[model samples]
Target: MKIILSPAKKMITDTDSITPDGLPEFIDKTTEIQKWLKSKSKEELKTIWKCNDKIAEQNFNRLENMDLYHLLTPAVLSYEGIAFQYMAPSVFEDSQFEYVQNHLRILSAFYGVLKPRDGVTPYRLEMQVKVGIGETKNLYEYWGDLFIAENSIENPEDIKGFKRLGYAFRPDLSSEIEYIFERKIETMTR
Candidate 1:
């Protein structure tokens, strides 16, 4: 029962007691997106991110110096937004941590999808951001069904079940985003 989640804008830089089990499965793909982001001018990035000067500059610097292979925190620890705060994975018991690591995945504009224990760096790309990859014009197009396809989950009923679990467990996540996910999941189920 793998559960999909949204990435958080807020992040935690301090080291946690838990060590990340591995790099994200889509590290190579994430690097591809980062390379494109790295190519953009700071102003361009600011406009694309639709953020203020400080956030734009900070994320620009993060993009410039980011080493996808190093200095990574586990996804559960890296995010510090409303949903993650509520989830409180940092204080989970060992068995609970293992359970989450196996059953959870976070969807990202930059990283595609991440396991709970997958290593990640701080960045500020939203799932609906207007960035393009090759001919793709947006994150959703770039991701397509790759995430669902990778998971090999094809049942519409299962997708509905997952959606219900997501809404029930992470009420902090936007209903609009969940609606989009429902549409996407239905598309994948077909």
Candidate 2:
């Protein structure tokens, strides 16, 4: 029962009490993306990131010094956002942490996909960001069935905009996020 989640833009590098327990499954793919980003000029990266000068510069520096093998923190503790803040993994009991390690995954533009305990560095790349690698024009194209073909996703439901229809949670036809989730599920189920 793996639950996929979105990566957060906000991040912090802290592993004071926790030791990273897992390695990213897609390190090779992430390295490829990082190499491409490293090759771009700061201005080009700023354009690609769609950020202000300061942010662009910061991320550019991060990219320039990006090393997949060093200075890593666990993914669950590395991200900071509404969902992760509420999750409060720092206080989670050992058993709960074990549950998270086995049942959760985070999708990313940089890392491709990450297990909860996967060792990750701080970066700013959204899953929706367009990054062309070789002939691939965007992240979706670059990923190209890699995620779906690799994982065993049985049911993908998006509760983002779903509402309780009396007793049952029904799909929102107008919700594109929900559509992507459902579409992925449909494709996998077929």
Candidate 3:
């Protein structure tokens, strides 16, 4: 079981078909991420899912607004060997490029790996983050074709193609904003 992230996004226009998990495993299912998740009670699932959404939404807002706070953090994959790529729900609904940008940034920065697609991004941005996974980097292929894969995988070796996993802005940097204005004022007065 391993986690995978790629940079090739396709339109999953099927709303009705989406599973209760909100994500159909059209991407990585390195290890039975769903099954493991399902082991939890419905309440626990809801709690974890919503909490992730809330924090992601909040941080995404700040990152998008503050052009200066350019950073990325290792998304701390909840369970290893269970890789996936995702777009913030807000961006996925509408074809907002910001979502694309942030999605790629988040993925690439954390995984330090991505599959390159020519038309997905312009030359400049693409060139900036094309660093492949480190030689030591380990990932299991979870099927390359996003549109294929009948919602999940039973075989581990079938994953071959790639998906869109973007590079994060700067992971180590903090998203928290500090009020240095007061400190500056005090220093000047002193």
Best-performing candidate as measured by TM-score:
1
Error of 3 at 80 (Å): 25
**Candidate achieving higher TM-score, 1 or 3:** 1
Q: Write the per-residue lDDT of candidate 2 for residues 55-169, one digit (tens) a residue.
A: 9988877777777787788899989976799899989899988999889888777887788888898898754556668877678557645664544444444233322111223
Please write out the lDDT profile of model 1 over residues 25-60, one tens digit for every residue.
Answer: 878878879988888998889988889999888888
User: Runs in model 3 with CA error above 4 Å?
Assistant: 1-12, 15-29, 51-190
lDDT of 1: 0.75
Worst 10 residues of 1 by lDDT: 179-188
Sort the predicted structures by TM-score, highest score first: 1, 2, 3
- Candidate numbers sorted by lDDT from highest down: 1, 2, 3
- Overall local distance difference test of candidate 3: 0.27
lDDT of each: 0.75, 0.73, 0.27
All candidates: CA RMSD (Å) = 8.0, 8.4, 18.4
